[model samples]
Target: MPLRLGAFVHRRIIAPGALASATLLLAIPASAASYSPGAPGIGDPYYPAYGNGGYDVSHYDLRLKYQPATDELEGTATLLARTTQDLSRFNLDFVLDVGEVRVNGAEAAFRASGEHELEITPRTPLPKGTAVTVVVRYRAVPSTKQAYGFTGWHRTPDGGIGANEPEAAWWWFPSNDHPLDKATYDVSVAVPDGTQAISNGTLQSTVSRLGWTRYNWRSNKPQATYLATLAVGKFDITTGRTDSGVPVINAYSKDLGDNYGAARASVERTGEIADWLSGYFGKYPYNALGGYVPNTTTGYALETQTRPFYSPRQFANGSNVSVVVHELAHQWYGDLVSVAGWKDIWINEGFARYAQWLWSEHEGEGTAQELADHVYASHPADDAFWTVKPGDPGPDNQFHLAVYDRGALALQALRNEVGDDAFFALLKGWPRKYAYGNASVAAFRAYAEEVSGRPLAAFFDTWLFQPSKPGVSAARGASISTRDPGTKGAPGRPESWKKIAATNGVHEHPER
Candidate 1:
């Protein structure tokens, strides 16, 4: 997910027949066998209907074909999963038209329900703990589909892109669309001969036929659905490796004009930045490290697993490695260790923002302490920036500036409270402990306390939970100072801080 500032109004469009079908599926007979219908939701407090229940997916094998001229996407998705309970029916988060569905080779009955659910009742109930293989064939014009008043599928002039935060997989593939259910992927996309398709992890091979070419990509590590991305377009691709031998593959759309040079300059540093980030945050989480810049009006960038997605706007003001640092930091916090719920976004955005501050210090721009002091002095006590609590910012305020900057401020405060050794140790140990899994804010707080050998309940409450500005007391830490409202105090910001703010500041509009 990218950093932007604004509230979003979510609207859902439900088909007329959807309600009746959903009602029928919910009516499970008590006298029947042990089998039951899987719950429609995975029970995230922020977005209850985001993910499905009853089965845990291990891998997704997607064979897809897209015709750029028609914007039509046809695919066969095979999911390898294990039943968590005896399930008579299970649901997958999807919006496109599903033509055929099979469970263990038997045809299953399925129908569209609500906005983005495919309700399927297999011929035989899936026994608990049994491994199951599900195959679905579907087709749709991804650009024409909308769920929750937004479309994750972006139609490029040459082809299309499947990329978004919290919700993107539904637009292109049937998935258990949430971070809690991480799975490996084998994405095979077929496009016109001249165009190219790119995805996560390693590119296994490319085979061309008469007029179409297929690109096969494999992600061996478990990944959240939203982190899986697909881009089909004409691009200038570059390949290299970090000093540690992590393969780096960067791509830029050929259609970009003047921004192409800056985009290339910033994104091509992916290898160097990843290697630099490895020093503070431990080793880079993925085997392949790189980024891509598509010719998109989307104003923000996203940490899409191995290959982060960059919007051209990020480089409009010349090379902006801060955004790259932000997204790459997420490869550790957001991609490697995901949020248990969306409200725990601070663990992702805040840590990533802090990485930008660290990068600034590394580049001789500003120290992390100086940046923290500058941000604290820049905002007054009465500013609404303090009102958005980073710990549990509501869904609309999830991407607010307060979440990113204040979240980083919270980390800086912790560094001031805890010794340098403990602070850095926690940062490096966190990803290793929860690597390739999901964790919550409370868990992180507990881990912080355990690692620092200090109870930080009050400190976290003041910095992350309270709506008002934190008091400048000795107990609250030494990073922030008390100042009269709207007064510039000691420790003035460095000159480079202005450039960083201009390039990475939270915008007035929401990012996709």
Candidate 2:
């Protein structure tokens, strides 16, 4: 199983003031634009060739056929995108053996160059902002790869689950395989008659023909390629809807035996947690709420887009429900507001981990402050948690203890520094502001500073950048010292939902 990667970005809001009435802009000349190949990568320092440049994909309609007996897959990925540059050629990240490539319905010249770059040459040069459809046909056995400390995909007993985090989308299909390029999805998978198939989003319709059953899933909300999942197995599925009416679907295999009972109980609790998170973190960010193929093989649970993947080990505490809370919280923090680069993964893992702590506090296990303090005190100066700070942990060191546990500590530290009013304002504001977009650590630092109206450079540096544990005196307070003690206690006191809902200067989605 793949470990959870992270989410969210903080954008600095600058009031226009007197300049609001002015309208001034610059225009580009036609001659300045020329046809050239789009870059092979999006310039991410960690994985430079991860996602292609030059186009913004709006939607992907994937028609796929899979045979469980033979472990073979045939797929046609139709990508609808608008070119951001004049291009005679462009690249897409694809690792499979391709049968054909078509640009705008015509067979185009293409080749699989290097390990993951698929160079495609169109019949004509595509102009800037030109809407074009790129269709790729391929047939191969679905495979998983391990890179960047994350497993690209986890093969299950029946079929497989897509766990591509940093760079694994190409292993299963052709894609602009990075979080920076998010697109809506329409996935239709054809499987044997009895075996069920699951993917992201709402199940639109199911058609049975001959010996195959086609499951059509539609994701209207924009989603990063890594967050996309495909689950095929013989399982028991239950369906319902959250109180707010978001559809809920849960699937689990029968191999778990008695563990299946606990899995069912956890699935039943998903709606209640979703409702709570929607209220705490803004409206649920996607069209559906679900978990797919909860088996024991996948060691880790992933916050896959509309549906999260779970392992029996994750629910070991039976109805503990922390893992469910963590993944559901990600729909807002990770799925809605994604990380701009892999390095800023703390934004995703940190937010989800903090939500887990919030769940614990809500359940009376302990307040977030107590949990944060416990973890912070347990780590010695020479511990691995302090060796790689969450902000700049190298590519191979992601999903370490620091990324999840210490990352939560950083958030609690910030909450303590800026009181509950500003902290909770940021919780709702950050996701709403960067909804359906990519964000970076720099953006987060600036956003936190702006929202709290405090200089937090040193705070972030000490908690997220430094490689040594900070001083901790349990009697004085939590690990990080608060410069301003302005009439607010630590983050755990019960507050009226009405007061949290009354937050001012907080940016919210217009629809909300």
Candidate 3:
């Protein structure tokens, strides 16, 4: 029995108590759309919550004709999805940062209790092995800045960083925000004449109509909704391959973040980093890899599945090359081996930073002093560092030292205590062992010890969990191959890691 609630798109017929807050751009997904196991909860077992059972959204074949006239998103989005668990419900988020929305054939409710949500619930129950179709029709002005109107300097005459995207992807459309819930996607972005539109994965087709442009993209692997992105601007396109021979296409917009040279570096070096990772670790975790560097205001990069979003300014003129390495590392560490919650951010940031270290050492420090200095400076050394344990990288430490410096140091110490062969062997196996899913910090630590054939408890306890950097004990029969200690254990001179250190926020040398 389906209860009919004749609520307008902006207002709900259901009691305000029963209907979640209908925020502008966000709302319900999965559980309410189809038959659900029961009423959904606040968080799911794997992904961010619309509070329901498995909302299997693995494959998408978006079929639509779109036009961006009058600055509105006018089109149809046909979605096909399956669930991991049974008993009926499915849900997802869509930016709907536009004017209107609808689902299937009915007037699906746009129930966003907060920002960036649209809920669609069907009247009947469907059994397992059943797939559902969702079609949305809508229009609105795409925000020039990031989603939700993040303020910035006014646009330059040419519309540079002055008009930047303040926030990340979830602003565009909705799906599960976290990576544990994967969705294979087919996206078609249509823009104005002479403008280019890009999304994740391969470009299947691009057609220009009377007055608008359309580009369709499809992703074969499962992906989180947050990483799903769309870019519409005047862009320069380049197609290339990674070092190990995986093909990729990169899009750079004129005066966007970076220009031709930066795009070239990303196309060239990001693949090389992938090869380095595969050589030390194992196969590239993803089936495909590429990126979209929109004309954006973000200072850092978002490692969105196979395709990451980079700010052109970082790579232009060869400035932030290691960022390419760090973000590419996230393809495996963040996108593929996702952390279960925001708390476990280190699993994403730490490993990526470690990749930068590996690249630094491989390239040669040009001198012993240079290499030693590079590693020491990267340690999160203040008493504050002690407070920001590996598990809890303090409020200030989350994206900063604990995750970046402490995380990198953790790997360096492990490599020192164990050997490079054993250390890298563990990293290579990590993604293969826990591909496209979540794992706790404890699980990772144990895996390292098991693979190394040594007890890493001291290394882990003293660094990963301990509040302070406990004094290093004697080797205790463990073979220690550290770079070098100088001036009574004080951190010595810095050099070699100019590329890596640059990305970590240090622009100067470490005091000896």
Candidate 4:
């Protein structure tokens, strides 16, 4: 028997009102051939209803058109997926009003149901392991909604930026909006001839006809839904390769004016930083390297797959080099080796924080150990930083200081336990082993213990699980020697950086 048929038979299939004769009822099995509705959610505790079940989406081909004058966005999404079980109906997370939906080239019945779910019922039942194609046409004015933070597609002063992280990908396109379900993307955007549109991966081509120009971009690597992005605006584009010969392209908003030169300089530094990151954390993971779309409306920066998005107000400051380091490092930790659930966000944030410290050390500012010890001593025992654990910081406080600060502190503690050589090996090995996949905190602990050839259950528990700050020896362990923070020079903006800040009218300061 088919796997789905057996499971469906156990559940209710017939109504009680149906009354049949004994002979007629006995003629057929109580559980006959019938397909069941796909599960509404993927069972995530924090975000239970965001990602749907019963189908594994492999690829998304999105064609979009934006009218800045009207703030309207129209999109056609083609999803290629495989049925994990016999599916009569499945859900695709969506927020925009849809015009039409099709299954395998035939019209399919669909309704906008629940919060951000587009439930679709195919004309015929799709058997388990069947390949399927779903196409949806939708149009809506791009708008931003507040979730963990302000995200979704936002209309800037003259253009727009898609900053969908967590569960906001459904705002612009229909998808299995979860990190665990990774898929490649082919995005094409049509905007006014004067504007530029950008997305992830390599730029395939650009064609202009009449008054509109269409931009084609492709991401061959598997990408989480949240990491996907699309930015349309009036941009100054620079196409070239990085210092290490990696194909690089950067798009900066023309709205910057005199500040545009500074933004371009910061973007040009991407290749150099890519080379520096490769030296410490193995080779560059992606094929192309460069995306620094400066949007003023966005208040923060995000590691959106191949290209990361930044805000001119926050990221263009002289301090952007460190900020750039943080987001770029995520290319390896968050983008390449993703977190399976929202709870494992530390693996992404903590690693990126540690990378900042490593970059500081490389620049002769301070060592990771020194920075770790200083941060540990600076925070009071009663501070909320220690109270909220990184593993589960609740939904609203997910990006709190604990995840970024204490999370890095935990890695530093582990480095103290395993020594420099073993710790670095683990850093390079972890991402390489689980490249383009997801891993949990428990998996990280087990992998760390395996690589170090020692037991660290107590060490992880004291820092990560406990609500209070651990003692110095507990954080550093007995094997590692304590380095005096005073021995290192006081942190200060370098003279060259100060000159850049003066010229750019921006300030350069280190992050907490």
Candidate 5:
């Protein structure tokens, strides 16, 4: 359950008077006749100003140092990229105190333009397809900065955690912040001698100096910028290997008093759960498998790459393995195969929610068909939940409950329409075809049609895009049985659905 904050409005500073436009136009260099400034945004309809254009990043090497006591972060980021077009200048999503910027070893001019855009102009125009290196030196107190009424930095008593949905890298590191552009990462951080710093992928090395310890982590596979995360604090770390030989690492904050046992009870099963999910999602996609529970007041969990981030509040009521199933499923759906755009979010959340239902059936709590029937029968014909189109949920309702529950219902409906053999093949084949890349809902629909050998346009339109509850005829056409077969009575919900619903309460984001 990732936090769905308010929409981010890209703000700009406007100079006063009618001469403002002309003054800005004159600032361009007259010598640049053939080259032009790169677009500031990556051109996403939902969030236009997210990532930059003109360059495709291949790798990011970050060397950082942090002092939790002072809440200051200093870093040098070097990016290896290739130009997509002839460029005079480009932008990186960042908000920090920049001391210097260099492109291919020469000093480059830089300035802050929009709320999060750092404009950089190279000493020489870069030709299309030219290999380039960019280095930026910057420092900032992340918790003090806010863009568009939100800050993704989480401050704790002992240290800080850099993990959030939609956006977080702008607070700690400059990047091409969008899922459309993914690259491998090398993250190296230095903290106090006794403190620990954790990030994505495998731990490469650790070197201790006079009073600081530096830990280096590397991700070999392509990763979305938002999927990158960092946590710094005192922790109890446990390491092991899964049954399939994938590495497993779990960390918990040392101060998580009453929630420690329950958190461990649930997260300790990461290996077993991942092994089970592989039966349906093919081989586990990543070399690392694990999770971490940081002591934060935020009430949601994020599928942060290899190591998902869990809030202490998730375990407030004892062990909750259901949430673990939801997040781990994301390793394949959300992390490995990300949404091409924000509107295709149902591909990430719906598949993960369906995994939970599969886990419930595996545990014998309820069958998948039974759960779908109960959910369909519980919602009335006039309920507003049916109004949300999971395939294209608007930005404001991106993480609405319908996107999870109703989205899963849509999958169950598809399973009934396509039969188990083709449905299971689609589940296992979708990730394999699009591993380490971005995909859209339209692509998935076409893939489903190919696998099932049936036209799914009308079925998909009824389940995903329609604004009202589907008719009884449509439900029967999908083979959904709304009533228990054992009872000779009107439509009735299953008792197991009540138990499952009670365990998963409607989680909400805390005020930042």
Candidate 6:
């Protein structure tokens, strides 16, 4: 599922404040640099090409029809994008699967890329703030891994949805793809009678007339486009809450009766983690959270929005709730305050991976130090990790263990050095800072330095840009020598809800 090639770029992302020319630079090792902290890639600008970089997407409406036997979906997407410039050219990111494009009621010329990309040039210049109704007609077959890693519509044999990533939904619709470019969504899906369609928020109602049915789901909160998800098929899902009171859901196939037992422990544990995380990060970022098991083909799960897509066959401990906590934490970091682009994926993978470790710590799976030790052990000892940004991070860097795990460990170390108060405070501050827009590796480095009140350039250079893992003892020795015993033991902890307030210094939508 690797791309034939990556996009060319003027600047590569190295972490916040870590931008570099596209030229190769070998200084440190991040293990899986090909896919980790500082990958090199160009910006995937908002669709409609933001007419002279003037607009950002604020809302969207989706219409779709599904053909189960062939596993295909046909649909039209309408979007409302906000811009400050009067634009003549409009371009959107779409796969080769989509065809036919009309802009503001006029046919537009376009070209295709991959199975999921289309470049359209509009006929007339659209004035900024003049919301254009971009109507796109398209058809798509499910994928193993294509276009933003979305494998749409996993289902149980009974025809119930097991997992869906609205991020993956881009193949089905066109809008601002980043969580930072969040907008309201209204989805209308046509499915057969035996199936139920589930999306981001509450189910409003389903209309079934004329031998056709359309299920409409609406989300009022500011939603990162990727959070949009739809699961269709058959599976029995039980819902409840934990002692701490976060809602819990477990979905399993009909024949997997014994598998149901795992849900008991998983759900409760999820609830506990939910309460604890929300307590620190702020209220649960969304209205609800759920886990859908679509017969585990993959060993891992995604921390999508309220609905986390999972595969049951990957349940190793017979208790798969750790996946639950990992995804739930994403509601705050990834969903609410989204990363700006693919290069900043560590904002997603690193944090989510660390959340898993954090959960293990909370559950007594290990001490925080032990978790860090485990991650450090997993990092590769080669220079490839650092020399390569995402594009150069290495061929296997896309979510590779070395980059995601080891990279996250770097932040964990920073957290420990900064103390829990500063550490969690930074976590809560990040998303809020870049709410609804793109961020760069440079931005993250700056944020960390600001929050830690310490310069991290050298530190980032060592771990984030180096071509290989720094010797553990060397890293530890530096930490010891540079450690400031005078730094407050633990700064005052910020109340979780404190970050609920948006600040003005940084632009949430950088592309805007």
**Highest TM-score model number:** 1
**Residue 41 of candidate 5: its Cα lDDT?**
83
Question: What are the lDDT figures for the candidates, one per model?
Answer: 0.87, 0.75, 0.57, 0.76, 0.85, 0.56
In the range 1-512, model 3's lDDT, one tens digit per residue, is: 01111212233365566545544223655334433442233253322333234455455554433333433444555566553444333444444443333433544444443344455545444545556565655543344423233432222212222111112333334444444455678877766677777677778878887776778887766665555666666667777787677877776667654365756655556666788877765788665677666665455566766777676556655756677778788888877777655556778888887777666667664332234334444343455655677665543355655567667666666776778788778888888888766776777888998999988776777767777654435222222223335435544444445556557641111210
Candidates in order, TM-scores: namely 0.92, 0.84, 0.75, 0.88, 0.91, 0.72
lDDT by residue for model 2 (35-55), tens: 678888877787777887788
Is 1 or 5 the stronger prediction by TM-score?
Answer: 1
Clash count for each candidate, listed in order shown: 0, 2, 37, 0, 0, 62
lDDT of 6 by residue, 4-107 (tens): 12212244457644445323355543222321111111234322221113346667788888766666777888877654344445445455266777877898
Superposed on all Cα atoms, the candidates' RMSDs to the truth, in angstroms, are 8.3, 11.1, 9.6, 5.5, 7.3, 13.8
Model 4: lDDT equals: 0.76
Off by over 4 Å in 5: 1-31, 482-512
Q: Name the lDDT value of residue 469 in candidate 6.
A: 61
Model 1, 247-326: lDDT tens per residue?
Answer: 99999999999999999999999999999999999998778888888887877688999999988888888888888888
lDDT of 2: 0.75
TM-score of 1: 0.92
- Higher-TM-score candidate of 2 and 6: 2
By summed lDDT, the worst window of 10 consecutive residues in model 6 runs over 499-508
